[model samples]
Target: MSNRIYEAYVVHENDQGKYKGNIEKKRVDDLPKHGVLIRVFYSSLNYKDALSATGHKGITNSYPHIPGIDAAGVIEHSDDRRFKEGQNVIVTSFGLGENTPGGYGQYIRVPGDWLVPMPEGLTPFESMVIGTAGFTAALGVYKLRQNDVFPEDGPILVTGATGGVGSLAVAILGRLGYNITAATGKLQKKDYLMMLGARDVIHRDKVKGQSSKPLLQSRWAGVVDTVGGSILDTAIRQTKPNGAVTCCGNILGAELNTNIYPFILRGVSLIGLDSGRCLMPLRKRIWRLLANEWKPTMLEQIAQEVSLSELDGEIKKILRGDQAGRIVVNLNINAQS
Candidate 1:
C-alpha cells in the first residue's frame, strides 16, 4: 500500500447555509472501505454532478463530498477475485457520486459489484467520453430498437440535441443509419447538430406543445427525448402508429400534462429510462455494444476534456444550458495514486 495524497473537488456547506465547491487535498485513507480501490484516470461531468456540486439535496444529502457519477480508471488494489490490480474499470450511478465518495477524487474505493471491466475497443478517456450520459443514451436507443423502431421507420426526433445525452444519442443513432431530426433551443448549434449526423434541425420551440390536445400529427417514427414537460408530450403526440419514444431526462420540467390519446390512438409506446439502476446484465450488454457496434465515429467532436480545476465553470455552463456536447474531467493530470 502507498501513502498518497491526492487532489479532489469537494463541496461544502457554509455557515450561511450556502454551498461552494473547491479543490482540496485528500488522503487515500479517507476513502470508503470497499473491495476495490481504483485510481481514477478520467471522470465525466453530468447534470447530476452539477446538482450535487451545488448542494441539491435530491442529488446529494451530505457535504464535503466528491461528485462524479461516471469514472474510468485502473484498479490499484482489490479484495475480490473478480478484479485484479492494473485492470481497467468503469463505474457509473448505482449510488456512486451521491451517497458515496465518488470519482471526483483521484482514488476511490467502491464495492466490486459496481465495477465493469472497461470494454474492448475503448480507452479510459474514450470510456469517460461515453460516460453516464452516453450510457443513458445507449439505454434509450436500446429500448427503442427493442420495440422494433428502425431507421426504415421514418425520421427519429431527438430533443435537447446539443446536450450530453441527446448529442450522444444522435451520434449513435446516426451511426446505426437512422434518419435523425434534432431539436435544440440553441439555434446557433444547428451546424453542430448536423455534424452529429442529424438530417434535419428544428427549434425546440417548434416542438413545445402549447395546446391541451392529446394527439398531434404523427410525424416521427421514433423519438429520443432528453427534455421532459412539453417537448416530451409533443414527441409522444407526434409519434407514428406503433412508434416508440424513450424519455431519460427532465431538464425542462417533471410533470406530464398530456392525455392518453397518443397511446390509445396511435399505439405509441412511451419508455422511461432509469440508467442509474439499470440491471447489471443489461448494463454490461449496452457497454459492450457501445464499445463495438454502436460506437460513434465522432467521439472527439462530441466531448470536451477539462481538468479538475476547470470543472466549476463547466458546471455553471451546464446549469445555464450553455454547454454543448459532453465535458470529460481528466483526474490524472498531475495526480498520484
Candidate 2:
C-alpha cells in the first residue's frame, strides 16, 4: 500500500442547486471501513450512474458522492476471513456506487457480504465489461425462463434496444435461441440492434398504439422491458397468454397507466426487476452464469472502455440515451496497491 492519495470523480454541489462531478483527491483511509478494501481495476457506467450524477435524490441523497454502480477489482485487505488480500472480486447493485463511495474512484471498501468472488472464467477487466447492465440482462432472462418462456412461444420483445440492458438482453436471449424484436425510437440505430441478434427493430411509435384499449393483438411471447410508462403498458397488453414481462428501469416514466385486462384475461405477468436491493445469494448465482454459460460471445464488443477523466462526458451521454452499450472506467492507473 502507498500513502499517496488517488483521484476520484466525486459529485459536488454549487450554490445554484446544480450538481457537478469532478475529479478529487482522496486517501485510502478516507474510504468507509468494513468488508474488503478493493483496488478497483475497472468500473462501468449505467443509467443509475447518470441519475446520481444529475442529483437525483432518490438514487443518491448526498453530495460529493462517487458514482459507479459496477466494479471489478483485486482485494487489498479483508476484515472477513472468507475473503483475503490479493483475491479478485466483483461488486454491483448493492448500495455500491449509490449511497456508498462507489466504483468511480480508484478504491472502495464495501461489506464482504456485498462482494462476489470474481468467477473463475472471467478476468477482472472482462467481468466489468459485463458489469451491472449485463447482470441485470441475465437476471431478466432468468426471470423469463423461470416463467417458462421459450423461443418457440413467440418473439421476445426487448425495449430500449440500444441501451446497456436492452443490448445485453438481445445478445443473451439470441444466444439462448430466442427470437428477439427490439423496440426503440432511434431508427438510425436499427442496424446496430439487428447485429446484436434482434430479428427486427420496431420504432417506439409502433408500440405506443393509438387506442388505449385494454388489450391488443398478441405479438410477443415474453418481454424484457427496460423502459417503463406506455412502453411497459403496451408490452403487457401485447404479450401472448400466460406470458411474462420483466419490468425494469423507468427511463421513459415510472408510473403505469393501464387496465388489468392483460393480467386477468390473458394471464400476463408483469414482473418487477429491482437490480439494486437484489438478494445476495441470487446475485452471486447470476454473476457465476455471466462468467460462464450465460456469458455473451461478444462481451468485449459491447463495452467502450474509457479513462477516469473521460467519465464526465459519458455521464451526459447516458442521460440522453445516446451512448451505446456499457462504458467501463479504469481507475487504478494512478494508484499503487
Candidate 3:
C-alpha cells in the first residue's frame, strides 16, 4: 500500500497554451493526501471532464490533471473506519477532475464522505454506466416528481436527448410511464431515442430560439433541460401553468435571457441541479433511486466503453456536442479488477 505504480490519463499544458492528455505512468505517492484510496475499475465521461481535459480555466485552472468526474471501484486503503479495504464504493464530482486529481486514473484518493457505498443491486461497471450524468438525470427527475410533476400532467420535454443526461432522463421517465418528447440537434439518432422509450423525437431547431412575447403556446407540462441558454428560455415560456423545469447543463450557453412571465404569471418553477456538490444525503437518495425503481431499463444501452488511451478523440467528440450516450472508462482493461 505504501509503494505502487499505476497508469493514468494526464492532461498537460504546453508553453504554447495548448492542452494535451495522454496515458502515462504515475505513482501512488503522487496522489493527494486523503483518507480513502480507491482502486478504480470504471469511470465515465461528461462535458465538464472534456472541458477540464482541454484546459478550460473555469472547470480546471490547474494543469496536469486527470479528468474524470465519476468513479466506481474497490477501496485499496482507508484511514477512515467507515470504509475498509476491498469494499466497493462510488465517488462523483466534489471537485474531482477539477482542482483535485480525478478518476481517470487506476486509483484515486478522496475524503471518505465523498463516497457512497455501492448499492446492493449495482456493480461497479453498472454504477459507472450511470455515472454523474445518469445521477444528475435521476436527480432532476426526482426533483420534478417532488414538485408534483407526474406522468399524467402532460408530455415532458427533454432537451439534448442524445447526450448522457438527456438519454438517461428519457429512459427513466419512460419507465415511469411519462410521455417524453426528446429534442436533439442530431436528428439521425431518432431511432436511438425512440428505443430509449421516447414517445416523440423532435429536431433541436423546434426547441431553440426566443420569442418577443412573454409567453408562447404552452406545449410541455414539464421539462428536463440538459443544454441551457435560449432553449431553456424557450421551454420556460412554453411550459404549462404550474409546470416545472430542471436545468443541469449549459452546453448551449450559460446566459439565460428571459422574462418573469414564466415564473410569475405561468407559475413555472425553474430548479437548478448541481450534482457535483449536492449534499451527501441527497446523493445517497439519488443513487438509491438510480439502483432501484428509477433505474433505466435501457441502462446498458446508454454506455460504451473506452480505455484511457482512447479518450482523446472521445473528448473532442463530446466537446463538439457529438456524443449520444455515456462513455465508460475501463481503467485496467488488460488487468483483472
Q: Can you give the TM-score per candidate against the true fold?
A: 0.98, 0.96, 0.97
lDDT of 1 by residue, 1-337 (tens): 5468888989999989888888888988888765799989999999999999998999999788999999999999998999999999999989889988887888889998899999999999999999999999999999999999999999999999999999999999999999999999998999988998999999999999656677788899999999999899988988999999999888889998788888888899999999999988999999999999999989998889898889889999999989999898999775543
What candidate 1 gets wrong by more than 4 Å, as runs, is none
State the lDDT of candidate 3 residue by residue for 1-337, as single tens digits.
Answer: 6578888889999999999998888888899876799999999998889989988999998888888988999998998999999999999978877888889989899999888999988889999989988989998998899989999999999999999999999998998999999999888999999999899999988989956688999999999999999999999999999999999888789999999999999899999999988999989988888888887887678889999878999999988878888899999885322
Provide the overall lDDT of each model, using Cα atoms, as 2-decimal numbers: 0.91, 0.87, 0.90
lDDT of 2 by residue, 1-337 (tens): 4464777889997889899888888888788856688988999998888899889998899888998988889888899899999999998877898899999988888988888899989998888888888888898999999999988888999998889999899989988889999998887988778878889999988887546888999999999999898888988989999999998888779899989999999999889888777798899898888878887877778888898778889988888778887788888655433
Question: What residue pairs clash in candidate 2, if any at all?
Answer: none
Q: For model 1, give the RMSD to the true fold.
A: 1.1
**10 residues in a row with least lDDT, candidate 3:** 328-337
Which residues of candidate 3, in runs, are more than 4 Å off? 334-337
Q: Give the number of the best model, judged by TM-score.
A: 1
Error of 3 at 158 (Å): 0.3
